[model samples]
Target: MAKAFKVPHTLTLLFGMMIIAMLATWIVPQGFFQTFINDANREVVIPGTFSLVEERQYLTPWELLTAVPRAFAAAQDIIFFVFIVGGVLAIARRTGTVDALIGRLLKKHSDKPQKLIFMVIFFFSLASGAIGTAGEYIPFVLILVGLCKAMRLDAMTAVGMTVAGYGVGYGASAFNPFTVLIAQGIAEVPLYSGWWLRAVIILPFILIAFHHVWTYAKKVIADPNQSLVADLPCPLEGKEATVYPELNGRHRMILGTFLATIVIAIYGISQHGWYLYELGACFVGWGLVITVLGRLKFDEAAESFIEGVKDLTTTAVLIGVARGIALILEDGQILHSIVNGLSMPLSHVPAAISAVGMLVIQTILNLFVPSGSGQAFVTMPLMAPLSDLVGVPRQVAVLAYQFGDGFSNMIVPTNAVLMGIIGIAGVPYDRWFRFCMPLLGKLMLFATIVLVLAVVFGYGADLEVASVFINNAGVVS
Candidate 1:
């Protein structure tokens, strides 16, 4: 008998969330956190400073329609970046450079392809863990798809190697200034203080995730029909998988140019605080350089680049739709209420339970507040004091926030980066969720265990021997 199957379209799911957010405005009391820029120019929530705010306008049928376009306006930067990067990658592929490189590499590793898979996983993890390169790698997903197809694997495997790997490493980040730094500051702990411990906790979890992906990859290789998208026409379908081509001089030049530009982009990010636009410019520049060197006709180059953009146009629109959920929550002034509701109960729990509770709360809150820095501004000040009263280490609280904010992006529809990456790969959100659910469970369980250990061992700054009471008057020594 054929099994029952149902999974909502990604846009349908996102629209459902927007409807819920609209209803929430009417049901949940509208509240706001008064925020001010700190000395570091970061906006932080003031503990005990939340107050009921008047709703500017209740969500109406028309507002729901406008919210999507407004969200698209808000996300123009990221959208343009996606278009440019997609175009560049398409141009490169059209040049036959990527195919040539893969042909050579796969021919050499045909017997031990798992070795190559593991290497890709580790490299992606390191980039995300060490430098906070989560969303920046979306363009690389297509390249990974190319690699996976060449190995007779599926697109989900490419996602596991790139998106999932990035999420795991990013969630278990050691020194990501965007998440760890802001969280440490608001939690009143030294920045990067818990790097050694974070590394110890995260590395093992990432290894487990890698093994999980590799196992599925091997299974799909053994039986192609077992792949999740076996019925759909995959981008890599019908491609020449066994043709081995020698890497000619033109291929080497293109590859070298792209690799060197990536290094430069990394340096720009680390040293100059670059973001999407700058990174997108790098890809555009590389594309132009390769086109000129390869001496492609203008029409040919433009056609290839436009085809790439066409392939990813759906993804770009989905990103805007996903952003609409967060947009509505913010405009409704109910985001703070959601955070307050989730965190208020931790005060009564035991110290260990409270720490774990923060992780659970943050995980849920990430659905509404997907931005790491934005969530930090909204939740950290309150969480820090709550940790103090319950004798949970400030660092443990930060870890909970880190794990919640980073890892949940792997599955959250509100997260445009996740949606965008998977959309580009042509994997539906439900299918991707089914594949990553088991691994996400493992990561969360491991995170909870780590939080328990942190509390048991007094992770990070020592809890003050003197009770730091938090009441109506605020923190008391």
Candidate 2:
């Protein structure tokens, strides 16, 4: 057989774009760009004081070189964490802990495929929300794919299901500290205010995802020769295979410990609130538990951890390179220019149209700037006020940002994890998009409709605060 091939077009294109964007950042006069944006916002005062004066402290060539190391360091932190989990998972697999538990769970849920799917989605979604980074979900994705394959379902079916479920869960996240709370924080909404409303949407979205994947899987199974169902690269061997295993006593102990750690972590987040510090503590505590309960020698566990981290090195580097693109756009002030360019045309439409316009704008911006919080930081201040001027509520504007940011993960090249997962699955970017775009459309449309309805019903940012009154207020008052 021909040696498995690795193509780097996505990575290459990302780097090339970053270089071009960064160079333009240095060459474009910052003053010229700011003047353009200031002139664009009609409702707000175009403060003469707010001039586009370019700060001349462009990153030196040396500084650009320095970003490489800094990027690597960030990547290292992510890789180290993954390595620890992966190593323990590998040990668990070798010991047959994971396999046994999965078998038991499957048997218990055999009569309810839909229930099993929902449980998996819910469990992983909760984990992603608590962890705050989708990187943590990679392991679960691997496990899902393997289980699906073992059950005679196509692997990509698992891919579609996992990614779509995650996107929906992440989109309507209740406990996501990173995307939800962070975006809310930037938009100045109180924490947990939107939880009940968000909760209402979760089940529907998860069902949509489940149906989407089930349909796709049935088609592939029925027509094995379909182009989309063509053979993918064989699954990664060695440590990657550790997430699933045959059931045994050691496996039961490790699985129990893992489940307990998850329960405790959720409790910790509820008590302490979700923050990186709390998250880090949870990871550390879980790692220690897995290390001790699995009974692996310390050296063996450490090696597994290192291997897991190594798996993500490429992704980390891609993330850093991707971040540089945003930094460059920030320096050039071109990001503002792009927003200004979009706002006027969008503002002319009716309020609902304008709301949709904001989502489209945010979607465009997301390709260039993938960070949910960072995008909100740069765009929301302007978006919030612009939304009000265009007769959209501030909260609705936030929802627009959320949909725009969340839905495009299915397509964005700059999302390293998306790319990394696709690479692991051996699906081309174009192929994945072809499969996912329809589902993305459904999600985006559903989310848009929800936001529009919320706006129509006067469901503003204060819904949660209102809930408190309903719970606590007296008729006399």
Candidate 3:
């Protein structure tokens, strides 16, 4: 058989286009090309350049230099925490504990498809909540994919469900320190004030995602010879089982300690809200439990931990580089420029269109910067003020951020977790996108309509909250 020839042109073109677009965004002064509208009447005119280099305030040179190390440190800290979790889980898997647990759970649910789908969504949602960081969710995603295969489900279907469930949950997060608290803090709203409302809005999307996945899986099962099935990549190779030496008493004790630690951690979080301190304590406890349970020497455990951290080094580096792009945009004061330029045109649109527009913008921004915390830092300051000017409440603006950030994760090329998942599943990015884009579109539309209705009905602060008025006697004096 003659092999088909392939060209690398597409990859090269994509990289070239990305670089050019980034450079264009970087060099253009904030608002440089946004002079078409008069501020008073919002009338259009010929667009002209407006440089902020002289008038704009931004991070000082010293600040920029200082931020690099600070950003790297923060990235490293996140990577370290994720690695510890991964290492502990890896050790647990090696002990056959996780395998036994997964087997039992799968068997219990396999008889009921609806129950199985709900269970999958529930666990993925729980993992998203537990991990609290998109980057940290990679291992969980891979685990879910493997579990799906074990249940004889289609891999892509599993990926779609896991991504949809997790993304929606994370989008409507109630207590995520990174996304919810940080975004609310930046918007100057009381933390978790609109949380219940946010959850309400996102619930429909979550249900839609469940339906989407279940239907897709059934379609594949019913027609195994479908073209869609042919398009998906083969199951990942080299998945043969391996035997390990029977655990000694020390290993058993260690395994028991590790399981107990996890239970305690979950219970504590449920009883008392999870804060940074709690998270730190959990990490330390888990690491110790794994070290003791694995019956490994200090050096051996350290090596395992280090190896886990090393696995995350590439992701950490990517994060830093991505952060650098934000730094440069901030340094150039272009982020503000970009926001200001878009706000007026968006405001002129109908409320529904404007709301959807905000979602779209946030999604594009997410492609370059996937960290929710980092994005909030860059966008909320601008978005909040703009929302007030455009007759949208601060809560709506926050929701827009959440919608854009969360939904786009399923499609964005820059999300490391998505890439990691694709790599693990042996599915190509294009194939995953083709399968997921329609579902994402439907959910995005559903969310947009919900937001539009909320605004129309004056839900949240838009309803009861009003500007204060002080009046003396109606005097002509």
Determine the C-alpha RMSD for candidate 3 after optimal superposition of all C-alphas. 7.8
Could you give the C-alpha RMSD of every candidate to the true structure, in order shown?
Answer: 3.3, 6.7, 7.8
Candidate 1: pairs in clash: none
Question: Candidate 3 has what TM-score?
Answer: 0.71
Candidate 3 local Cα displacement, residue 130, angstroms: 9.6
Model 2 stretches astray by more than 4 angstroms = 1-8, 23-50, 54-68, 74-76, 105-115, 122-133, 174-197, 224-230, 238-246, 267-292, 306-312, 416-430, 455-457, 461-477
Range of the 10 consecutive residues with the lowest summed lDDT in candidate 3:
468-477
TM-scores for every predicted model: 0.94, 0.76, 0.71
Ranking by lDDT: 1, 2, 3
Task: Please report, as a residue range, the 10-residue window in candidate 2 with the lowest summed lDDT.
Answer: 40-49
lDDT of 3 by residue, 1-477 (tens): 998964333233234434444465545665433323333233221223334555544345555556556545645544455555656555555445555545655667655656677766666665554345444344455456556665656668666766776787676666666667766766656677776776565556667878888887777666766425455554432431333234456555655775576566556655665543465467667667666665667777666657545554544544443344455554455655675565557767776667777877888788766777667766676676666666676777778888888878777755655655554455556667778888888878887886797677655463225322112332312
Global fold similarity of model 2 (TM-score): 0.76
lDDT of 3 at 361: 81
Quote the RMSD, in angstroms, for model 2.
6.7
Q: For residues 379-462, what per-residue lDDT tens digits would candidate 1 score against the true structure?
A: 999999998888888889899999998888788888878887888888988889888888889889888999998889877744
lDDT of each: 0.83, 0.63, 0.60
Task: For candidate 2, write residues 1-477 as lDDT tens digits.
Answer: 998875455567666777777676677555422222322232222212234563654656665556556555644544444444454455555455556665665557545545556666666555554445455455565566556554545557666766665566566777676567655655555666656777787777777777776677666556765536475553544433334445667666666777776666567655665533454455666656666777767787677666655655555556556556666566556665565666668557778878888888888888877766666666776776576567776667777787787778767866655765665555566677778888888888888788778767756646445644766876323
Once fitted onto the true fold, the runs of candidate 3 whose alpha carbons sit more than 4 angstroms away are: 1-18, 30-51, 55-87, 123-136, 174-177, 181-191, 222-236, 240-288, 291-333, 420-427, 461-464, 467-477
The deviation in Å at residue 174 for candidate 1 is 1.3
